[model samples]
Target chain A: MDNKRRKFLKMAGATVLAGIGAPAVVKLTSVPALASGSEQAAAGHGSGHGEEQRTGIRLGMVIDMRKFYGNEELLNQAIAACHAVHNVPEIPGRKSEIKWIWKTGFANAFVAQSQNLRSETVKNSQFPVLCNHCDNPSCVKVCPTKATFVNEKNGIVAMDYHRCIGCRFCMAACPFGARSFNWQDPRPFIKTYNPDFPSRMRGVVEKCNFCAERLALGLEPACVEACQGTGAMVFGDLNDPQSEVRKVLSEEFTIQRNAAAGTRPSVFYIV
Target chain B: MIEKTLKGKPAYWIWLAILGTFIAIGWACYFRQYVFGLGLTGMSRDVSWGLYISQFTFLVGVAAGGLMLVLPYYIHNYKAFGRITILGEFLAISALVMCLMFIMADLGQPLRGLNVIFHPTPQSMLFWDMCVLWGYLLLNVLCGWVILTAERKQVPPPKWIYFFVAISIPFAVSIHTVTAMLYCGLPGRHFWLSAIIAPRFLASAFAAGPSLILLACLVMRKYAHFDAGKEAIQKMTTIIMYAVIINTFFFLLEFFVGYYSEVPGHIHSLEYLFFGLEHDGHVYNNLVPFMWTAALFNFTGLGILAYMKIAKVFDYRLVGTAATLIFLALWADKGLGFVFAGFVPNPLEEVTEYIPTLNELGITLGIWATGFFLLTLLYKIAVGIEHEVEA
Candidate 1:
């Protein structure tokens, strides 16, 4: 080959290599850098301006079900608080019901790992499960429109109800069974309408936003606030090492709903 | 050309009236569903997809099945399929219409479904399925119309029509393969996760698609006095024989993989399908009987088709009977059994059974009637031209 051709080939090869390598290098380095920034945000949470201004903050919850083991009223209060705040409908039938957060047995919650030989207390426990708001959410991936998306700044899987075509691919794709479709008009079944949060229309999928609206208002999730008396649920930014969720993870061993699914669920349970 | 459909006998008019009544009833049911939402269907949070999706999956195969005829006739220059090529193409068009309607019926927000296009996401398989389906539909309409129009004028088809015919061969394969990908690409759904799904989809499509066309040909020969010829029927039978064998082989391969590997994820869906799963004294066996019926029909039809091929027998009655059995078998396999099988023992490891309500059935029947109505009219026009040319 001529010199000019060789130079062109080398340049072309270098361009392709740069194209592939740039993203990998950026991804590998960006996480740790973001971690430090979120730590600062955690320390500065008491400072009102810093908490609201920080980006790339992943808000998660760790629920200690044992705290409320005998107290069904507390559990109900937490669930009711979240639902009312978000305007989640209580549709009459199972076929068409919409739920953001609900309870399921330990066995049902963790299908991948074996729990057959566990104690009665552990086996019979009603664990409050919601959208894992995973680090890698399948629902966000399968949505045909950008109706469901992961916010890069905060890593919360968010939904745009207006843009959703209601194809329900996300419902099928979600392994956690976290998403729910609005089967009929939700207005009739909602006992007390929360005028603050807009009620969703029929046909769109809705799930626990981890109380994104509350987070924006510099308040903890409604469920977390409701559980404050019992101290069952702890909410904080997972990226921040100084955050309460990180301290809880450091101090105690906790398990996610389905670890093998590889969704990296934000919701952890300390049994 | 439209006048030809209008001139059919009293029997045709009666058929039209029957189809029209069902269409009307189906629309009335759909209107209720539209007002109330998909709550009217048997689908639940656990089983979000139901009858409409299953029918869509089955009809996509029927739509892609057109390639079996189009390939042999156009690409290979096989003269035997000359008469019925239009029939296959028109059959695809009708099936596609039903497929689109089924999708619309299944959507929670049919009105906002265009949001998929308004804000397209390449990451989602549904977007790709839509692209391929629409392209395939347009390709068939253009090719079928141009060729049929040329035939009526007593001239060779326009050169541009061949470009569409060539593109359609691959486009047809993509449509069903893309449809399979819609299910197969899902991460945790074990039943649809197999790599063999796309190939099996094509194989089943070939078996089901040609069988339906063959039966339609037999009906046309008897009723409309239009013969698709002995050579054509025998050739199509050979296609069905190989397709049925391959389809069965792929299905058995899945069973072997699931059973031998002994993986719980893979085995759970099949176990629930072939045998009922019991949880907390509640038994779910809705699909057990249906799955067994599908196996019986598939194997019996496979045996009959294989014997015909080996014996070199070409009895129209026997072939038509076998085709009917295979068609129904795949209808059960792809339609009733496969779609909801993935959702059994749903993600939460809880069983939620699905049984379509009467309203759902009415809508399904309406879609079928609408398909047949389109088929009747299109075939009537084609047969009229054939009669005119022969005379």
Candidate 2:
């Protein structure tokens, strides 16, 4: 119906409002004026500039080894919190993977340490693993759809499982091996549906969304809260100097996992 | 038996009953998989691809393998293959059908299988494999259809169909080459990431495919009885022998590179398969033994078939056995080992061995059964009407 009216107006030359006698009335009656009088008119012009401006809120994290003492409970708490909030699987099986967060050693544990020595065996160490939310994440580049994307809002690299086709290319491209494909539907165990995190079906790939929901709610991530006594993970806005992560990163030396890969990971760990 | 008249057979009913029963069982499992997700399959994070994919890969080699026979007869103008030429084309079509359907059943999201179609990524080898396999299938189908239609009408086909056949000749070679490229392109996989992988795949396809076709022709002659002409198979055996020799040579090349380079990633899978992983879940069952058997059969078959020209009393059986051995040997080396050797010593260089569960084996059997049924049905239509054996 709208298309027909637009065609009729186009045919009558009324589509081009500049030629109309009442320019003021045309401006007032325009879609912009109808959208939100003065504020929108000003904001719309500002939005053009807004898109050009780099977002100042560059979210990041810094891990301080001064705090960690090999506490599995604290580590488990942090991992479970992130998983719970993000609807990561409570089940621990092969075929049904629902891991938004997991664990491994410094050597085998990818992300911050792809080439760390100890390929042969372990050496009294463990680490919580999550999406580094890399500046140039390999997972994002290889995605067939723009399902995996880095948002400018807070520089969080997020995954939309609904848009995922589960080709497993993202899994292959991820230098951190952060991505996992949904080999099975993830809906059986939930007594009630959680609106915060969307459930993924079989045949789509998924990864950590970096607690975008908690960020929207103006709350710290579940991992951050659980890391309370653990002292290892220090998640905060790296853009703000006053932020704990920023302060920690500035005062202490830190390195990224597979720094040579050139992904420029956001997660910082002192290993 | 098929030539006397259109008559009834007990084997047909038994085949139907067996196929129907298995399809029903497979459908039940497929439904359970749909409801629960890939949870029904034995695959996990570590073992991402399981038996379904392996079977599909093996079947594709078997299908595209038909090109080995098709090329010598049509392209080289081997007059010896006269009556048997149609039989090769017929077997190729059935094998291709089985290969494609097996792939369809392997998907976790079988319904969204169209995503690969609707949104194809050219960079992904999966897309290219789909293209090559489909191209080979269509090319063979059109060539066979045109030729058979012309034979039925007792007239020569339009000149272009033969040109299409000419194009399909090299294209048949490309199908399995592209299939190997699917694995060869993956960088991290030490076993699959070889340069000779694609050429080696073609070599095996030629050796195994024509040998299988020759054996199938013999079976056709023996049962539901059609004289697919022995002379054509004699020429086909020649092609098979050459292919087996090339394949064996390329196989040796891979071994030389792997051993000389001493790269752990390259050597690990080979070590695990032959020498056995000194740790968990390591079974040396049939790895070295089967490999040597395949080599022995190929060597002996090549000597007999290429020398006696497949006409010697013993040559026929040796060629058939060699082809069968090559097919099964490549199947194990490529399929099961392809999956197992890939993730071993783990990508992270950790040690997590794989043991396929019973559920996984059941699904694999179900898919294989489906492929066989499809082959059976297609060959019935194809072999029944094959009067293209012009003297």
Candidate 3:
């Protein structure tokens, strides 16, 4: 090849190499900064409440079905408390509804455990279901953008509304049907907007965060606090054996929703 | 040269105008969808994916189907296909363009689409799908354009072009396979959780893709006076025939597994799709007619193609009809039947049937028109060049 041609080839090759390498280097350097930025955002949201940020905590919830079994009013109150605090919209239809926590028949809740000749109590009772914050959360596994993620600092399955692309891949992956998408603008539907929590925009997925913000503020989840005196809903650190959740889990004959799914849900029901 | 597309006949201009009108309407509908949100569509919380995603899945098959032509001609040294390999590559380019548009339309935060690139989670199947699809599109455009340019100049393509062509062969397979893995790897969606999904996707794509190419070739032969050789068309028909049989067989395997296992999780979605699941004394059977129609068309098309192969008499009219039937059948099967069926009983065992609204349909039609518009332009250029070479 002529010298001019060879020189042109070398320049083109270098240009191609630089084109491929430049973005990669930038992405690698930015990843840690982005991660820390998200961590700081998580911390900053819960920081001003004067509670020390806790780490090495696997937050868990236990619902004693015995207390909640026949109490429809109490269950509704618990659901209301969570929704009211979190600014979850009260959309009218099943299609566009944003539900953080909701009640369903026991058979529907625990499909595997339901027997053909089950007692009327088990069949008639309503179970309040929420995000299990599974140790192996399938939602987190499928999130292409890591918008919905398991908080490493505390095992709360959380949503970064700003980051969510609304692909709903997480919704398909979540065995529990815990995630809800903002199919439309959610603000108009919120009758009473809680200033403390941010309402999501249209085209993003939102779900129960196990009240990660509340937990950071040294407070129990809204649902757990709603049923505080009744001992129906218990929220605490599962990593701490002395914590109420672990104590209750150890003592009670508890079952998880779709245990066979192998997601290892942190939420359990005392049957 | 692309300039060839600019000076087409009145029919071509009229066709372009028609496509432009549909594209305009689709864009307007998409604007409404953007403003109103995905709630404007039939998709609910239960059926999170509907027409947009279904079309994306189907078109991915169409895009990958280009491999049927590329593989045989390049790997097997089939000289007959030499006349029309560019057509296959260009077809792939158009289909992939539609595939990407459908994905963009399906997203909730379409603007945040860059987040997929920004985050780059290797664990997510969607990430790999994005990678493979973009790579395949690039490879096809490069291979098709470079080769066609070389052919136009009456010279052999550069040695480097063959390297890219080889990469594109496997790259085509990966696009559809990765798309399948998007559904199959998910936990608890039993309808999509099978090992056969990738194979099934490939089988249907092979049938659908070449069926489209066959139809296009017949059209060009009649109108543009461009012939892709009789032997090449016959061989393609045989390939489509076997592909249709294999596609049907793979689907049946899914049925056998679902029915024989007696696993409610496995059977429920299939039942909901085909026979309508009864819930609260109301049967959800919206997709039943469509699925059955797909079955009918698929079998009928298969029979016709089989007859054509056996008789050794290729009638252009009959071939065109069979190709259309098979194309529509695969579209209904992969596009309509496959996607929402996975979401039918949902993860919670609740049945919520999806029926796309007018806005959704309009947008879908628009994307398809856009693809065809691109296809027409590309074919015009290719056929124009071929005519020049003949002259």
Which number leads on TM-score? Answer: 3
Against the true structure, what is each candidate's TM-score?
0.91, 0.77, 0.91
What is the per-residue lDDT of model 2 for residues B78-187, given as tens digits with 9 covering 90 to 100? 66665556656666666666666656655555666676677665655667777877887788778877876676567877899988888877777777787777667554
- Weakest 10 consecutive residues of candidate 2 chain B by summed lDDT: B1-10
Q: After superposition, which runs of candidate 2 have C-alpha atoms over 4 Å from their true positions?
A: A1-66, A93-97, A110-122, A132-158, A165-177, A181-185, A189-194, A215-221, A228-231, A234-268, B1-8, B279-314, B351-362, B388-391
In terms of docking quality, model 3 is medium
Rank list by DockQ: 1, 3, 2
Greater-DockQ candidate between 1 and 3: 1
> Candidate 1: where is the Cα deviation over 4 Å?
A1-55
Model 3: what TM-score?
Answer: 0.91
**What is the DockQ score, from 0 to 1, of model 1?**
0.59
**Count of clashes in candidate 3:** 0
Given the true complex, what DockQ would model 2 score? Answer: 0.21
On residues B87-176, what C-alpha lDDT tens digit does candidate 3 reach at each position? 899999999999999999999999999999999998899999999999999999999999999889999999999999999988999999
- Sorting all predicted structures by TM-score, with the top scorer first, yields 3, 1, 2
Candidate 3 regions exceeding 4 Å error are A1-56
- Using lDDT as the measure, the top candidate is 3
**Highest DockQ among the candidates is held by which one?**
1
Q: Could you list the iRMS of every candidate?
A: 1.0, 3.4, 0.8
How far out, in Å, is residue B43 in model 1? 0.9
